[model samples]
Target: MNDRESKSKILWTLFKSMFMLSACTFGGGFVIVSLMKKKFVEELNWIEEEEMLDITAITQSSPGPLPVNASVIIGYRMCGITGSIVAVLGTIIPPMVIISIISLFYTEFRTNKYIAIALQVMRAGVAAVIFDVVIKLAQNVLKTKRALYISMMIVAFIATYLFGVSAMLIILVCLGIGIIDLIINLKRIERSAE
Candidate 1:
């Protein structure tokens, strides 16, 4: 394919992927990340698993929502700014349309006891899905530093849930530690090479 044709195809693929992710994901951005990995990394082979993880980290650190930011970054990596725009639009459209309709009818439907019970059940499902995603993410992260990452995960959980510390603060601290570790590792490798 020529450059333009290849770019167009890439943009279209990204748009479709983002659309599927935004539509199928019921819970939140984290769940969408798992779905994105399944589609983009496992199914489509558009990006590698490690690259997806790196994208997730960057998306988390930057401003705005995770899924949208991720879509843009992935799209840009795959194609360019045009691909990013297409992916972002695809990710946004489904949720916007669905939420608009739901918001219009929500008040009327929310008062019904059966509907409330159904929603409660759905919440349980969503929680299970979120937990599954967390476990998968933990598994992936733990592959490199099983003990340390697990300990950090536990500490982060306790700090956030029990001690009432902000997740943002924990994330910042972890990012700082990761950067220090990266620098140290690079220095060690460089010195060894020398």
Candidate 2:
């Protein structure tokens, strides 16, 4: 395909994927990341799993909701600004429409016990999905050094949950440590090569 045509196709795919994610992801944006992985990595083959996690991390650290930001970055990577616009629009539209509709009859919906139960069930499912995503990400991190990454992950979890440390601080500290470790590893490899 020509450049323009390929770009158009990529934009359309991003739009459709984001729309589906927005519509189907019930609990929150984290669940959408799992859906994005299935659509982008498994189905479209647009990005690798590691790239998705990196994009997710960036999205989390930046302003705005995680899924929308992720879609923007992914779309931009695939096409450009236009792709980002399409992806953002698609991600926003479904939730906006759904929320509008729900708000119209929210009182009635709120009173429905079956609906409430179903929502609770969905919450559990979403939690499981999020946990799965965490495990997958941890596994990827562990590939570099199983013990080290596991230790870092544990420390991060403890710092955030138990010690009540800000997650942003933990992430920044971890990022710095990771960079330093990479530099050291690179030096070691260079020395070995020499």
Candidate 3:
């Protein structure tokens, strides 16, 4: 196949994958992230698990919706600017359509006893999924076995959970520490090379 044909195939696959994931996913971005990891990292072998972890961190830290941010990064990684656009379109379309329909029936949906029950039940499942994501993320961080990273993770959790510290503040502090660590590691490498 020609280069254009291959690229087109990939783009089509990317769109379909994102659309399906977005449509089926519930419990927000963290839930979809697990599904994305399974699909992209485990199933497709498109990206490594480590890359997915990095993507999760980056997406969580950046502004706006997590899934959209993730799609832009993942799409750009796969197929540049065009891929990002396609991915965002796929990710947003299902939710947009669903929300539009839901809004149309807002009063009926809000008042329906059966619908209310269903939504309440769904909250339990959503909580479980979010918990699972948290565990997986924590495990990934622990797997590195880096003292500083492990310490930072623990401290950040403590600060947020116990002290009610701002999550944004913790993220900023971590980001600064990460930058300093990177520079220090680079300098060490240069010194060793000399």
Against the true structure, candidate 3 has what lDDT? 0.93
Model 3, residue pairs in steric clash: none
Candidate 1, 62-180: lDDT as tens digits: 77888999999988888778878999999999999999998999987888899889878978877887787778767787887757667878898889999999878988988887788
In model 3, which range of ten residues has the least summed lDDT? 25-34
Clash pairs, model 2 backbone: none
lDDT of 2 by residue, 1-194 (tens): 99888778878878888998889898787889888988999998989888988898888778789889998898898877888899999999999999999999999999999999999999999999999888888778788686767899989988888999997898788888889989999999999999
TM-scores for candidates 1 onward, in order: 0.88, 0.88, 0.95
Against the reference, the lDDT scores of all candidates come to 0.85, 0.88, 0.93
Q: What is the C-alpha RMSD of each candidate to the true structure, in Å?
A: 2.0, 2.3, 1.3
Worst 10 residues of 1 by lDDT: 144-153
Candidate 1 stretches greater than 4 Å from native: 146-150
Instruction: Give the higher-lDDT candidate: 1 or 3.
Output: 3
